[model samples]
Target: MTSGPSSAALLLLADGRLPAGGHAHSGGVEAAVVDGGIRDIGDLEEFLRGRLATSGLVTAAFAAATRRSCPANGPVPDGIITELDIELDARTPSPAQRAASRAQGRALLRAGRAAWPGLSCPLSAPHQPVTFGIVAAAAGLSPADAALAVVYGAVSGPASAAVRLLGLNPLAVTALLARLSPDVEATADAATVLSERPPADLPALTGPRLDLLAERHRAAEIRMFAS
Candidate 1:
């Protein structure tokens, strides 16, 4: 039998139905839509493209880095995870965005640890990408697997949101995702390349509009998603 987590584990983790509170988040897509920014699937496709290139790239790298920081079948170094969290916070400029990330991280951590007792995440609350990487390590997944998970979730979350917000056809969104698969694989591989670097060296890509929208979303009177 193989020693590490199987490819099926990747499928399970990447699925949106994992109950990680991801459903309540549009990954900032809702805020954009609320502002009359994204009108339909065409706009959503653009948003997804931009997100994948910017925040998606950076988060994927962080996931890979977090996995590298975690010890595979060994004790994790104290304070290392904390440092990773701080670095991620520096990358996230908005307070609301940070909170949203941590909440999801905590949820994913709970699920990840419970699902795989061998995995140990020292941070009580880490950034989502960091938790993903460390959990990937614990589950015997490679840095590439972590990257795949990160990039996939980054785009998929917003795409799912587009369906609900714009009342767009689900099949069209699925086709859009299918068309973007090659780019997703490329982004994951790029992120995997940065896995061995220190947190400081990881990419610091940002989305100013997404950050602004996050703050707006937090203060809104009525909203469907959490972030």
Candidate 2:
């Protein structure tokens, strides 16, 4: 039997219209822009590319793995999912970033559960990927689709922030997304590797500079984004 949700379901999860409170967070782009790392559309695009390669890829992998491992009619295995969440948490290394991630995850969970009833979501502290996987599974979406949605969300959220901060053209933003499509797919493929085994078996790779940026951003007296 097939293990994916219908196209409509995938669209719902991927749609920017979903009330997941994603727009409230900038995914760190605002801070980067303010710090001079991103000045214009080009810089924002580059930042997104690097982000998609590292944190973006990792999140997609975990979400995909969770979706694949979760059964349709039962609670997902806590050991596996919690391990993945902790891995993400540990890699983050920034208390601000961790709090921001968990905040978004909890918001998404509350909204998603209400929007789509009969879903099995854990009461444990949710990281973004864990909530994503559970929501995708509940919606009958496939791991691959869930992974793509996550990667797309990660990319777009920051890009949107760039547009507002830098005053970039919306059309340019859309084109940037088009250019990143191949990278997104490639990242999704890399994420799919997680389906082969649980998150614990995966090799360790974390970005330290990003963590520092998150921490620095938090300490700043003036800030537009949460983290």
Candidate 3:
């Protein structure tokens, strides 16, 4: 069996460190929790599963697709990247959520470019998945690996946030990760297949309830998360 990249590097992208500003956004979990939609750990898991099925899956697919399309040692393609960005923008209906994703994407790009030179990242107009895919490619991770990392990051960010907001047990939360590993792997596999195709061929499976909550959360005066 061929060994993949160093575990340390994979951890760097997946560790939730690297200064991506992901901590500031909760992937709509905060709104769900505050509104009583996500009341316990079970609710948190369900919410994250739905997110993975929709935006999370789409984002991973785009990232993996970009990685697949990008040359191993050539300039990143701007056109495809732009297409993914616009797609993400259209999918994210809530203004607040759009702003949040862009803000985080820009931050991730800035940090990624600084850490890995020769990384070509667009300005902050596009959403997070675009920037994330570019950064992952620059980091030398394969498309499948990038897809898995992106999917894991998307789900874990909110899961971590729930730990703080709901005061859930850390051990239990870690255990949840183990249980959800299969789902994450499956999503990544699906994303990789989708990435091979054009964005037009991609399915539009965004969650309306999540969008509604994000809109309502934006109107709130006091909020812990950016979106």
Question: Once model 2 is optimally superposed onto the true structure by TM-score, how far is the C-alpha of residue 15 displaced, in angstroms?
Answer: 2.3
**lDDT agreement of model 1 with the native:** 0.87
Deviating ranges (above 4 Å) for candidate 1: 1-5
Candidates, ranked, TM-score = 1, 3, 2
TM-score-superior candidate, 2 or 3: 3
lDDT per residue, candidate 2, 1-227, as tens digits? Answer: 12444667777777766777787778777777777988988888888888888888888888888788778677777777777787777667778878888988888788778967876665455887879888888877788888888889989888888888788999999999999999998888787776566566653556665677788888889877777
lDDT of 1 by residue, 189-222 (tens): 9988976788788889889988999999999999
Top TM-score model: 1
Best by lDDT: 1
Clash list (residue pairs), candidate 3: none
> Which segments of candidate 3 are over 4 A away from where they belong?
1-7
Local accuracy by lDDT, each model = 0.87, 0.79, 0.80
In model 1, pairs of residues that clash are none
lDDT computed for candidate 2: 0.79
Q: Number of backbone collisions per candidate, in order?
A: 0, 0, 0
